[model samples]
Target: MTQQTENRTPERGTHVYDPATCRVGEFQGKVGPHAMLRPVGGGREWQADPGKIRRATAPERLRAGVKAANERAGRML
Candidate 1:
């Protein structure tokens, strides 16, 4: 872990936005210099700088939840 990663505290299920990739994910945990994030609908996880992470807005969270629900429904088939 690096000093910068320790500076910011992230909560579990913490929603974050990545302007660089125009993507969003839930903060799972911190690893080294990056924060671990899992996709909203259960895809591969990615690492990102904690410094650049920002909390997702209400609309974003709602959209993610709906997407996850739909994905799960599809998997039940």
Candidate 2:
């Protein structure tokens, strides 16, 4: 991990992108060496290396939010 990766740990509640999973999630906390992340609208959390994640971009966040809303709407029928 580079210095940036080694030193960066997103604050809790921040949105980050996990390249390994190609998904955006809210940073929950750390577990061992992995950062725990949850889906934007709330769902099961997954572990991702802190060294491999970056903050989510605006477009990414928008997409995730829309997807979550759609999912919820689908389930409401």
Candidate 3:
């Protein structure tokens, strides 16, 4: 994981993740220890963990979640 720097700003086209609400958004800027962005709401801003945002939106995590759910249902190989 990349250590966040005090001077580092959110990448222009990067995505933001909000663990509090389990939501993702286009990167805007830093709003404290988290990334800020406007999500589904009309021009509303939210903060999220940068690393978690990436992981939460990653295809692998999605696949893992699906696999886990399937396993819980006794559908895994």
Q: What are the TM-scores, per candidate, against the unseen true structure?
A: 0.77, 0.92, 0.43
lDDT per residue (tens digit) for residues 1-77 in model 3: 34333445567655445566766556776666767766532247766665445523475345545654666678434
- Count clashing pairs, candidate 1: 0
Query: Which should have the higher TM-score, number 1 or number 3?
Result: 1
Find the 10 residues in a row with the least total lDDT in model 3.
1-10
Clashing residue pairs, backbone N/CA/C < 3 A, model 1: none
lDDT per prediction?
0.78, 0.89, 0.55
Candidate 2 C-alpha error for residue 24, in Å: 0.3
**Model 3: which residue pairs collide?**
none
Q: Could you give candidate 2's per-residue lDDT for residues 1-77 as a string of tens digits?
A: 23227577779999898999999999999999889999999999999988889889899999999999999999999
**Superposed model 3: Cα runs more than 4 Å off:** 1-10, 40-42, 55-77
Clashing residue pair totals per candidate (backbone < 3 A): 0, 0, 0
Candidate 3 scores a C-alpha RMSD against the true structure in Å of 8.7
TM-score of decoy 1: 0.77
Model 1 has an lDDT value of 0.78
Ranking by lDDT: 2, 1, 3
